[model samples]
Target: MNNNPRQLAFIILQEIHRKQAFADFALDKYLRKNDLIDANRRLVTELVYGCVRRERSLDAIIDELAKKKSHQQNPDLRIILHIGLYQLSYLEQIPESAAVDTTVELAKQNKF
Candidate 1:
């Protein structure tokens, strides 16, 4: 499957969730398999690590914004939201609009 950084991040997140895979291992495996450019690969790495590290806080934001607990969400949707929120909340260099738009597209493309 063709994957942008956000899409790749979504897949990595799902792998982590479903397989209970180690976050670093899953991210590295996927990044190595994909043809993503260096920048996108870096973004995917950051998103995967950031989401895993801040999972509790990210879920809290999801809960507050969506009014649904993370466990209550579709797994893909939860992961997408976490990626978007992580970028928005932590990555000062990324524009807010880009983060949100890419995240929404990732969800739509994944049929979430």
Candidate 2:
């Protein structure tokens, strides 16, 4: 697949936050529509849920670092950062730079 892992992860996350979509439904839809392999799809699912579950903590960090209200800040950047920070905080196998770069790229893509 041309799509990278983090990009796929970002998509799942975006669907969660923007659509308020459920994890199973969102993941199933993405898997049916996309060409991602099972492994990457699993990563997407995991990252999406993991980020969502930790949202309160993420919001705290965003509030502390960016000084913006959670509802007022750009959703795109927030999701991007959520996914990135999730990886950075929990995904030991994922390199730190990849998390930062992927989130920044997602932010740029959304013009945030």
TM-score of each: 0.93, 0.83
Estimate, for each residue in 1-112, the C-alpha lDDT of model 1 and write its tens digit.
5457888888888999999999989998888889988888888889999999999999998888887788899887888889999999999989999888888887788787
* lDDT tens per residue, model 2, 1-111: 435666766777777767888877887777777787778867777787788889988878777777677667777777777887788888898899987887787677767
Q: Each candidate: what lDDT?
A: 0.88, 0.77
Model 1 stretches with alpha carbons more than 4 Å out: 1-3
State which candidate has the highest lDDT. 1
Give the number of colliding residue pairs in candidate 2.
Answer: 0
lDDT for model 2 comes to 0.77
Worst 10 residues of 1 by lDDT: 1-10
